[model samples]
Target chain A: MNRRSLVTIVSVSALTLTGCGQAGQGDVDNGDGPAEITMWTHSAGNPGELEVYEQIIADFNASQDDYQVVTEAFPQGAYNDAIVAAAAANDLPCLLDMDGPIVPNWAWAGYVQPLGLDPAITDSLLPTAVGIYQDEVYSAGYWDAALAIFARQSVLDDNGIRIPTVDEPWSLDEFDEALSTLQDAGYDTPLDIGAEDAGEWWSYAYSPMLQSAGGDLIDRDTMLTAEGALNGPEAVDFFTWFAGAFEQGWASDSGTIGNEEFNSDEVALSYTGVWNAMDSLDAVGDDLLILPPPDFGTGPAIGGGSWQWGISSTCSSPDGARAYLEFSFADEYITEFADNQVVIPATEGAAEASEHFSSDGDLRPFVELSQRFAVLRPETPAYPVISSTFEKAAKDIMNGADVGSTLDGAVAEIDTNIESNDGYGF
Target chain B: MTTDSLTERVVLRRRKVWSYTAMSALAVIFLFPLVFMVVSSLKPDSQILADIGSPQAFLPVGDISLDNYFGVFDRVPFGRFLFNSVLITVLTVGFGLIVNSMAGFALSRMRWRGRSLVLSLVIATLIVPFETVAVPMVYWVSKLPTLVMEGGMVKYDFGWLNSYHVQIVPFIANAFAIFLFTQYFSTIPKSLDEAARIDGANWFTIYRRIVAPLAGPAFATVAILTFLPAWNQYLWPLMVVQQESLRPVMVGMQYFFQLNTAWGEVMAYTSLITLPILIVFLSFQRAFVSSVAASGVKG
Candidate 1:
């Protein structure tokens, strides 16, 4: 080819390639009759979950003509980073789902705005399902996930252990005795506390034990510093018992993240989430008992919140986004989501209609636990740092670090991060 | 035979056996993970997890089927992801060859002023990690103008986010690729360029006819190197492309990693994604190895 012809071909190819990236199919305010608003979700691989959202969007679109919602789904693992990058580029969508715990950081970072839904809808929902930061509701979820002690009723009966209830959960001492009994009955590990999985699981699964022992992640009263609450004596006591479980050969951080060990009958109890309840029930039949988490000292506690919906700060049509958000709270959709995803529905009416999470259903115990035992993570922008610091300290403790000094170090790190960001807007 | 000869023969035989044994063991050690991934991909999630503690994990034992592979497709747009990855990798490597080789030619054969300094600066950038400048690059690219088809007329848009060009463009002119090309071209005799120049040839003609044709190993080396990183990109695409249809295979791996992870589906997805790169490497094994050894660039 001649040089000039080659240059022309190359320039044309480059221009064509550049033109291939049409703007994303979202609303551009051209003074149109009906605006098209973009929505983002983190349900890329979850067809069952994404189907529910798509139906809701379709119904919402048909119900009104003022705005038509266009939805995009990203993989759950990559969703937050995409949101952050889009926020940096000022290209955020009109609406998105925020993991309930991270709502504060996003709201504080000005990525999301207060949802401002009606009180009738908000008050009828489970408190744990509401995403509150700084005295204002920023997000709300369709359902909440609760943690439980998954045990086989036949194994408990074979080992002559009492079945614990929500009102009379096993105390720390009784739980210890049950573990010893299960161990004596030839189970190598009596419990799988999911220490094998790192990241937020460390805080979500184990931090509640500290709370049950009369300690908290941070001082909710001030939402500043982890000095007294995190490293207090009760907290240390909880960590000591936590580490002792591994040392005493009753539990170890070597098992898989799910209820695999329990389903395989390798362990007697699985400290896991409601997501695994259906699988364990299938594996063990009617013998599976989704028991409440054992109380350490003060009371039984479980981590609250799941993914919740919110409008972004840069949304062009806040009224349309809020309309979709409010419309999504319908009990029919909530029950559909809860049924499809096997989670505890947020509203009582939804729970009543949900086959799996109704008052007398197979998973009713999870609903009760979520209602009574779920404790929201510290509602401060400093929670991301606090969660990671707590995970590191908890891992170190399980791996044989000195409990007091390790927690003190975590406190130092959390306090440093909090102070660095001016207590993260306390 | 004499006693000394017999003993020496025995000693040499034993040494050969030991060498073979050690090499066989090393081969198995290196091959275990790939074998495990392929074998586990055929099994159900429960069986895969159950066999992890036993030798059965590396073997296709117990209940095995193509269910996970089917599950992978149901979960993700595997074919779309694979196509996106191959297209991006090919374009990046193809355009990269032209751009970097030309840059290499100017730095190596041409006697332009400040060539050494420019080459030095390009090599210096090899130490600056892509992660350190990724956020800044995103911010800059978001502001750069791009031609977008808007209502039947192409117009300029401010951001490059969520586009295929955003993934392909930033990665085309690589520092390591330029350095490899320059080093390889420097080894080729400059007499070829001089002879081509004497034959009524301009610099582009000399570069096209002489240096580029002679730097086959360098091009091969650059192509393989660029293809690997572009194919395996995770973080950059995650930051830029939010649309699922535009996502590559590496990001598709995250689709199978929900709360209740599908281990079998992940392995299946990985195996499917890995097949293309594996096939590419195998088809060009000789060229890839020779190019890497000649250019001193790892594949």
Candidate 2:
């Protein structure tokens, strides 16, 4: 062929391929073996969770004739990056699971579509477990995890410390006294707040404390900035005490990540989620006491939200994806997920039926904690940015940075980011 | 003469002793993490946590078992990930040595127009971090065409997503590899190439039989360097390859990093993945060290 003709042909083919790649995602129902519905999850290593997911997928596929659901499980640490990359390629799966706080950002970025879940399912879930932005439900989870102060009843009794309950959690003064009393009782570091945990964990594990101090990541009234809510008096109060925990040697930032410090008797108390409850119970037996988080001024609070399900914006068979979600949220599956993964089931019925969190169950208090004290992270499209910014500020405060200036700097950064993105559509 | 010679010998012996002591300490410091990982892999998580901040962490003295190894296999298909990593690394290194070495020969030994500018451009890419261009690269690769066998007929597929080639191809033509080869090949005597040409040999023949044989250290250096990155590839494979069957071992490390990380399993997986790299480095220790020393590059 002539050189010019060959060039023209190649260019045309290239453009054709580009267009086809974008259009190809929409061509799933071309009689290609039951309109394949691809689902992506972050349960690659958790055999318990992955088993439940596989069961759901198998049951859903067998229950259907028009659509077949397939799943791809990525490791939790790498799941977010994979989703972002796939969205860029227009190759996102029909069914995608994302962490709850990320729902708004992904929704605003056109990665996920707002769900139209039946209100029966939406109302059945813990309020914090349903991800909503601008009055639109974007995602819902099968389970929600709540954090608690894990203590041993025997130790508390021996140390002459009051056993705090869900109704009457330790106030700020009581908690401080308990830490001091434990420290004097020969436990060098009395609390394991998991300060060494990094990134989104800083926000997920600590922001509820900020809320309990009457501060928040952002002003939810406007959802435009973190000005007063973050750098205000209440936030400073929370952060000062947070830093003081480390400064006073009541907690150590160098300890292990999970309940190990508590399990090994290196620490008297552990600030951990329900995921660690089973391990602590295994070690401490009936002495394990899952106490509610300390109430600073407003009420006790624990960071709420966990991984949730959402449909990708570019899904070819979104209805089928929704069908799978709806099918997967049945009480039996939810209870099984709760029992196996040791997370609080999102629905009350499931919680009631759960082997781990039902009436008289070992970890029953977590259900009350999730119901009463669960505080959702700021739900705006600016959340991803807000989340990291809060993590940095909280980490700095924990490391003894000046609370006021650190919080102010964080507010400015968050405000600038929101403004830079036009308030992240508020 | 006897007194002076005896004093000098004594001084040399003391110096040898001091240097050996210092080197041994440094070696122990470096090997501490590896020992801890292997030892921790055999113990339960609780014991691993308890042994922290103590010398016992380095010793497998209590509860040494292969449970974590069994857990590693139960959690992930270690064999599949190992095969994928080996296949990708071998193919990448095998192809890389040929393609990059030739480019280096042409750039360094042959007379070509714009050769200097091309070499500068290739090296310039070294400054651009892979992360900065990862999204764009993902887009382009998704639009690229590939051939697929559909019912015994070769059909053109649009995207390279989820396939093995996506992991191997984009990484083969490495900028660092090319730069290493060009600099290494440049150090060889041009007289060898001229002699080969005098025998009426073509440029390809000279590159093959004359300069390439002399650039043994260069080939070894490039092979080792290419193998490391290929074996340790994480982000690219995670982005493009979605199938569990096609994932590399580095990405499999994430499997153990859940809300409550499986500490023992993490140590086990690291110890397992680390074996091949240790083997590769130890097998070519002398050649690798000599090449790096000659090239003045730190591995």
Candidate 3:
């Protein structure tokens, strides 16, 4: 090689090496200039929810000189993997949002830390909205979603099936009778149970049915085994009826994932979440009814919780992140999210001011349903595996496999996984 | 006409009809998805779901409009994502062809002590998936040094995160591309190199003049193959590229998958992004076919 070329290469390498500095959330927060606080959200495609967040960020940044919160949005479907990858690179943002049921797993994995907020702030929020892992509040959200049986009053009156209320939801036999009556009344599929959807929707939608049947995902007292709770007699009863619904032609496992069948007058009843309520109301108008789910021996139950915000353990400006979150929980912002996303506001004050979820509002039934029947998913780090296993077993039962054996297999899988992870730090 | 001749013509006509009929059926089998995607893109979500179980899914019948195509822009910055994808894809393919071909030339024409071992190592890397190394690559790239312009001043920055180069750099010099070039270049006789050497041309000149021009089919094949994965990149960019401006088109697909997915918008976005690839494939159809046949026949 030539001497001139060698000298030039050496000089460039030295200059590049000299440029190396530690990469993190900008500069250290040492009472210097406003520290850059990075925040992430799984709200990229959700314009209604994301707009509220962006407004809160803009207001917060303008109100403070000690901190500047910069936000990035990711699609909900791919957000979890992005956070995991960022954590692996030791590059997690200062603040990020996660689905509510996943909080315990992320907490146990050391991906997030407690918010260190006062109890007074959280006490006013909905019980199901806060994510408490190991007695510390790791995350919280502005709203929680509730599920209901959407039906038309005219269809029920025509079929001679009584309308179900939150206080007087249908019993197991009554629900069966109603489905049969609707099917006989010329509805091809009487119910849209959303069985065609994949992944977390399975456990979220069906586990509540099991809970109402007197079965739990795990014993909440010890939070360890799925043995008796998952495969016991109560769970068996629920699975049998679940399978029978398809065989008796009351429901079909073949429909679009959302409110299509119900809106098209093909199904007389739709068991869906609040997000689908607007479309059903538009389709059925004044005849639309939002009825509670059936009570199978126990009271009615619906899945609780939605996306919640939290702080990462590796955050360089933890205080700044906490400040942003605290500033964002005002009642007006909460109401804005509720009105925009068509969800139940997490606080009573927010609900009172909300357009759809308020008193004398069109969608107030969801609030009553959430308060009366909402049940949070099992809070354990083993929930990830448990949820997946339950989905597979439930799907197998729906497809005509033996219900007892499927539940037994699911119990064994969950128990073995918990034992392998040492009870997931119990 | 004689009876035998007339019978022979009848058989020929029947054979021709059967051939065209079979070809049309196969074409429909392949083209059905593209047709459905385009037709569905023109319908509302309710209409799209309603037509799904019938032949109406393949037709733009009732309630057809360009609303979804326009809605895609409101949801996503389609132009920005397209530009990002094009920039990343073009840089990766252009750099990949140059670097891999040079490596192929060195391994094929030049004498070296561990040439075969290096070629074997490059081929072995083809078996290892990119997902396995993604985390380590993200960590290393974050620590890599780069120059950035801030407020009209050139400053040294430490991380490659939230940058375009990170998306472009890590994907260049693919192992499959390198192995392909090596195999393709080996088929070019070394006698060209020897003759160029006797004529006072350097190895690089010999590669540029004699070898590379002859490997046009291989280059086109590599360009097409590399162009695909680079354009369709999702996970790596999702991991490393934090800024929305640097994200590619595949990542934009996730934007339509909210709680209640915008099915019409998804189809519209897909149609827009798939247009470039279909154009690339059509434009290079012959070279792609020739390169695949050439590689397979040689093997």
Candidate 4:
């Protein structure tokens, strides 16, 4: 061959190799022929979880002949961004594991399809697990978690303090006294509420404080009634006192500290979710103790749904997707998952299967606390606006801004957003 | 008179010492974060929190291991992610230089119709943020059906955000790159191209034989800028690639950080990701410094 022919041959050969490389490894079996269904889930870095999922997929493939599910995992942070882009590109997967907050958002944006759950399937889930928006069940939960307190048992014992139990939950005053004692013991900060970072602390620590003080960020009945309450005396009093703990050197000034900080014994207490208990225990090992969230009369505790699995709107095989969901929530699978993974289950069977809860510590406290005081965050499409508003107010408070004014501003911002988003009331 | 001369020499020496001190201080300030990142990655998670206020806490003193490095591999598909990143960066830089240089040469040297207008249009596109065009671009890419394989017609739905093409293709012929090349190519003597053409050489042959060989400094500039962005790209990659297997190091590192909140592991993974770039920079430090200096002089 001439030099030009050689060049052409080489280029064509290179192009052919590139094409072969692009053909991903997975045989599609969509009954009619071989079809590949791409599945995306938010479980990227957890090796243990990924392993289980791989097993599940293997089992699924073995049991089925119609379709092959090619699972792709992404971390929680990138999951939402990927979903939005995927939706825009019309390349959404056959199934997606999403957070509860995103379900309503995607549904409102008309990117999600209703599962149309049969009565048998719907009956198995917790009433609250049915994440409904606009009178449509957009998604269903596979796991549930509640805002609870995780404390270093060794630190509490060293300070001669008795940790609160589920039934005899510490009152707000008592909780403050315990924190003060720990602080006075020369531990620079007694609590790692993670106020600096806009995460669970807003829901677990600040929201509960507001609830205990007879103030709600959003009234459950009206959803609009709490604009005044956000900047009210009760709310301000709790925030100022909360800020005082930092001023008194009882809480770290760094707001970005997370549960891991507490788990590593950097702080004595962390107001985090029950779901973090296993991970925290893994970090600290045997020195950890679970406590009920502080109580203030009959007030609600900030709670929200955990992880949920849903079939994608663009899924090619709905039957295959439905079967997977059904199998995932089945008694045996939920039991095995909860037992092995240390996750809180969303179904009654899974909850009952907790007789086998093997964290070697009393797991009943978390279950009971979740049952009693757990109040779901507003499931409106406007919840992200609320979360951002809360985050801004929390940041302002942490930065020494006047709590009342900051919260008032946040409330106003949320109100404006709600009004602009067609004023969908709860 | 001799005593006075000796005293003057002493004064000059003192001034030199003062200047050296000032330069050292600036170097330390610039190097602090990088040094700290390296040290912190070696330390245990607990020590990171415990010694937050102490300089000693920055160093990995006790119980240091290669655990964090291993952790990165175990927690995420680090190897595959690295491979994907290498593939994307290599393709982007390699293809980018060829396409941009050709266009740059044409626009700057060749007398083509609407050359100035084309250059302006290319430059104008740079003003628009990628995010603003992302949704529309995704829509257009999804609608493109020609990319399908011929045999099965397995529609190559450009699922642009989820593949290598999205990350590398749109950015291959960057306006900045074209402009940089054009500026640098303009500096080259037109006589070289003219001489080559006088010998019966075609435009392609002239470009190959005369223009490209003389455009080394410009090519280096384009390669450096293009390669760095391709390597460090986060938002675009995060937006595009959902599959863990397809993600680059930045996206993989994010998952590793979140899943394993251990400071040591985080540091290790960060060090691993950053070490390659650091090594590359150090190896080509002279070229980088000279290129910047040359670019500054030209500007």
Best by lDDT: 1
> Per-residue lDDT tens digits of candidate 2, residues B65-101?
9999999999999999999899789878876887788
The lowest-lDDT stretch of 10 consecutive residues in candidate 4 chain A is A17-26
Residue A425, candidate 2: C-alpha displacement in angstroms: 1.3
With a 3 Å backbone cut-off (N, CA, C), the pairs that clash in candidate 3 are none
In terms of lDDT, the poorest run of 10 residues in model 2 chain B is: B147-156
Q: Residue B89 CA error for candidate 2 (Å)?
A: 0.6
Docking class of 3: acceptable
lDDT of 3 by residue, B1-299 (tens): 99999999999999999999999999999999999999999999999999988999999999999999999998888899999899789878977887788888888888999999998998988888889988899889888887765455558777877777777777777877778888888888888888889999988778788898999888888888888899989999898866677689999999999878899999999999999999989988887888878666332
Candidate 2, residues A1-426, lDDT tens digits: the string is: 344764575465434323322223332674647888888899999999999998888998899787888788999999999989988998888888989999999999999998888889988899988999889999999999888999989999998899888889999999999999999999999999888888888888888888999999999999998999999999988889998989999988898888888987889999998999888888899888999999999999998888999998888777888888899989999999999899999888998898889887888999999999998998898988888888888788877788999999999999999899997786
Per model, state how many residue pairs clash: 0, 0, 0, 6
> Who is ahead in TM-score, 3 or 4?
3
Candidate 1 chain A worst ten-residue window by lDDT: A22-31
Candidate 2 Cα misplacement greater than 4 A, ranges: A1-27, A30-32
Interface RMSD (Å) of candidate 3: 4.9
Worst 10-residue lDDT window, candidate 3 chain A:
A13-22
Residue pairs with colliding backbones in model 1 are: none
Taking the tens digit of each residue's C-alpha lDDT, what string does model 3 give over A1-426? 344664575456444433322344442554667888888898887888889988999999999899988888887777888888788777889899989999999999999999876677788888899998888899999999999999989889988888888878999999999998888888878999999899999888999999999998988777889988999999999999999999988888889989989998899899899999888889889999999999998899999978888999988778888888889899999999999999999999999999999998899999999999999999888889989999999999999999999999999999999998999888
Tell me the TM-score that candidate 1 gets on chain A alone.
Answer: 0.98
List pairs with backbone clashes in candidate 2. none
Docking model 2 quality class: acceptable
Residue-level lDDT of model 1, residues B1-299, one tens digit each, is: 99999999999999999999999999999889999999999999999998998999999989989999999999998888988898788888888998999898888888888998998999999899988888888788788888888778988877788888898888999988888888888899988877877888999988887778888889998898888999999999998888888889999999988889999999999899889989999999999989888888764
Error of 3 at A112 (Å): 1.0
When sorted by TM-score, best at the front, the candidate numbers are 1, 2, 3, 4
